[model samples]
Target: MDSDEKDSIKNESIEEEVEEVEPARKKKKVSREDDHEYTVFIKNLSFDTTNEDLKECFKKFGKINYALIVRDNVSGHSRGTGFVQFEKKESVEICLNQAGKIVLQDFTLDLMPALPKGKVKQIEKEKEAKKVEPKDSRNLYLLREGMIMAGSTASEGVSATDMAKRLRLEQLKSSMLKNLTRFISRDRLTIHNLPDSYDDAKLRKMVVAKTGSKPIECRVMRENKPTPTHPKGKSKGFGFLSFSRHEDALAVLRKLNNNPEIFSANHRPIVSFSIEDMNVLKIKERREIRSKLNNPTYQEKLKIKKLKRKENRKNKSENKPAIKGTRKAPKQVEENEDAFSGFASKPGSVPKHRGTFKLKEQSKIHEKSMKTQNKLRRRQKHELEVQQEKQEKKFDRSVKKSKISDKDSLVAKINKYKDLLKGSNDESTKKQKSKKWYVD
Candidate 1:
């Protein structure tokens, strides 16, 4: 061959060798990275779709290694979700991208990559954690939406939503102020025994006359307010008085709290703090209770519930029929004495043919016969006792044949018997073996 041809041949062989090595390396890389089974979780499938239906629909894209529509184990019905595994990774990508357009038995497919069982559970836990949200500005907006009437329409520029929120905040502020005012006048006094004829002006004059100092405010509730029918508001017999100083209020409370002829000339006054004071005390008590319950080391403080279960088996085992306190036997009964059933027989269970007179005669006859039977039984019992004595004597004589065997010699006797049996070769051994037949 020519030199140029030989050089061309050597280059061609080297190129072929390099091409083979490149393909081998590519195959190795594919095995390590892209060799996993490309599985897709498909949802919104028709209930009638079967594994065969899925395989036929997806087989056009690539060779499907497996296709299964999950079914209820008990009902054998499709679960509307399925798994499809394609042999090639590119097929899964193609299926995912075309998921929106693909239709399976009148339903569009929803497809995504199927994660491992552990990863699915972890994702669910994260979703649950995200669901628990703290209070924020959005809560007010939500409340506004709920509170607005359906018929009430909204307008632009400071809509009803904002108006509702502003109104709610104002109401909350007023309530907070009221509560604070109550706590601030914790030492203020109230009297419930004032006469219904007394008014706010009259009570104020009395306080000034007694304490020699004017109060900050005096409120008197009317039993009925002045209306078109009445020109004067009737006093309700209860009122609150606040002082500028706590010491002045305490001094006024001590003198006229239960004093007659001051607020009440006839009886003592029901004097105390406002209802808010009691509520504050209750709040403190509840806080202490919650703290005790929340303590982890105090096992008894935690709520423990005891459930009562019906003891079916124990009650059934204890079910026994009453045996004593039987009713009197009926007259004219044809029932045999041996046929005495448990407790008692029904009232009308006697045979129709038996007469009451026959029953009375039978009772007398039965008594006389019982007496004769008792005498005969006594004679027979005596004879049996004599016979038992004779049998016992015979048994004692037979037992005496073995004559005072020592307990310690039992092991020696057992060993000696075993040796005698073992020494036999055929005849005696065969006899012993023949005697070993079971009783049953």
Candidate 2:
């Protein structure tokens, strides 16, 4: 083949290889447009189902960008619903059709497009409404008039209007009136061992009959077992009864605390109750009072006052000169004669001078005794040294005598052994000579 023909063949081969590689590149970039995608819900999942399982199950129809299985917050178990995102609307419809009613473990799946934003908001609103409605119903009794009272300092015969003014009802309404009235009127009644199927209305009727009230409000404090002290399950057989009147509440407490019949089939008591005043105290005033009561400085001041009184008593006792005996008139006669005459008299004339002279004499005697003790101790030390020297000389002489005697005894034994050995050798030689003559 000519060179031009050969180059043309080589070019064609390279072109074919380029076309093969280009198709793969195009396949990678060929993704379904974002507008074509929508989230699809997959329901009836097994409790243990996971996101990866949902993706893998849907991937057969088309590309699944993401998948998730909803789980319960408390149980950490699947909620039997999940979401799957497909890259194409067509794929989403296909997944819905194919996966719908699919049996997974013990559940049958339901596939549909996820609720739109508007529908989601509506559902959330419904849930919030349901939650708020119950609380409002429980608290409706607080709106009744004449159910609360202000402090007694208000005008003695004050009407409701006057009382309201004194208590600042306008501000109270905006802040604490509702809560405080509710707390004051509320009574805690424990219903024990109630059946699982017991309803609040039935429980309320039972409480009303016991307390003689038209309506009784009750709430089952949710049991939270993980918090063993507070179980999350329905109160096994007990719940609290809150009354709208303090009179009814006190009556319930008086009658029910340990009355066994008040409890359900479980025989637990239903009469326990606590009344709490929900009034809010001024924090600053409370804090000021507490500081005064607990102040370390205040306590220290009290301690110092006590110590000062004790010290004054001790000083008074020490400063009061001791009286030798009861007062005498001779002491006055001497004072009247002359204070200067006493000073000019001889040094030993007065009893005080005589006591001083005796004290001096005692001190001299003690000093002379100490000097005699020192001389005796020195003489004892000298005598001890002389005795020690004599003992050391006697030990040296005894050791030398013992050494000479041991050497003499050893020399005598060696000479005696040598003489015996010489005699034995001479006898042996004579015996050998006699044997030699016989052989010749």
Candidate 3:
């Protein structure tokens, strides 16, 4: 009676133990991420939109747990996006089902589930950490197969299959590692703060001078077309320099980086193994500059520049010599042959004066100067015409105001100017008609 009872009780106990263990084991494989409630991301916000407005808009679906408009970390202005937290999961689903069509501040919104503030950064960190966690399957397999047995040699009867596989893996890993380095890097030089006059030829010359070997490729960053401010495709302040040999690139970096005279004092030079780091640095730099655009110091500097430009323009106009329409041409001036030493003044040929080379040697320089002067004159003429137009409009506005107020003097002055302009136009037309050489 005792043996039978003992056996039956033991069997029941073992069955119950197995059932409990099975559920526990299965729990490890299960993930409950879908159940996680989250804040809803709302995109396409207007700059003037406030947190209060967003919260009010989100309140119709359900009780808002929290709501916030994402703002620039440095400037404290809206980044044109926001998040709304809901108390219930049903509300988030309803918002998603709306297809992000909530019109707030005249913009149809785009919506998605919002992640926690550092979730993205944390995930990136995890991915990086995972890479360094010894994930080599071959290594794991070798260790498990006792292929890494200590004090073993070829004569010790180690499996030929295991040895061959191990050697093959080692060779493959080495080759891959070498190729990986190549894929991630290129010999690059970062030229920053390029001069306004920097060109591809000059850049190549400089690179050759510093490195003693010519770069495989050289480029001076330039705009594709002229802008309102820059009438030429000017240097964009930075460029990439590449070399076939990395050593030469390193030489350039050591020679030119921060040596202001060669690369221009304004733009610094940097040598890099890869252009990626340079690009990343540029991005960060641009972000910092953008963040500081609203800064008082930067604004003051801009105002100072504007004032300086105005002053320079004023001084230039005031100091300019009057143009003489009948001035003698330089080529028509006759000179004696004995007037200069070590040079002869020949007819129909440019002659260089003693210790001074002038007029024709640097035609490009002269051309650039002429172009600049022409541009300045055109700009001044335009500005003057604008000023005149503004004055006329102001006078007309005053005349209208005077007529409304029954002031006769201002109306008379406006009429007098209008009559003068009309008379000038009539005279010019009459002159054109009288001239025999007038073009139709």
Q: What is the TM-score (0 to 1) of candidate 3? A: 0.25
In order of listing, the candidates' clash counts read: 0, 12, 1
Candidates, ranked, TM-score: 2, 3, 1
* Candidate 3 residue lDDT tens string, 1-440: 79999999999999899876454234324434542364688888999997778988888889875677888989999999987777788999998899657898789999988765468689989898777434332221211111122122211222233233333433433344343222223366555556677788888887777647787778877888988766668788667788765455545555554444564333344333332333565789999899789677988888999999999999988987888457675333222121110111122222111111221223334345446666898999999999999999999999899787776777877888997776754777678657787557
State every prediction's TM-score relative to the real structure. 0.24, 0.26, 0.25
- Encode model 2's per-residue lDDT on 2-102: one tens digit a residue: 99999999999999998764543343345443422467877778878766667677777788666767778898787888877666788877767775456
> Residue 422 of model 2: what lDDT?
58
What is candidate 1's lDDT per residue for 190-289, written digit by digit as tens?
6666776677798899888875767787888774668654357776667888876645654565445434456433344544433334477689999988
lDDT of each candidate versus the true structure: 0.59, 0.54, 0.59
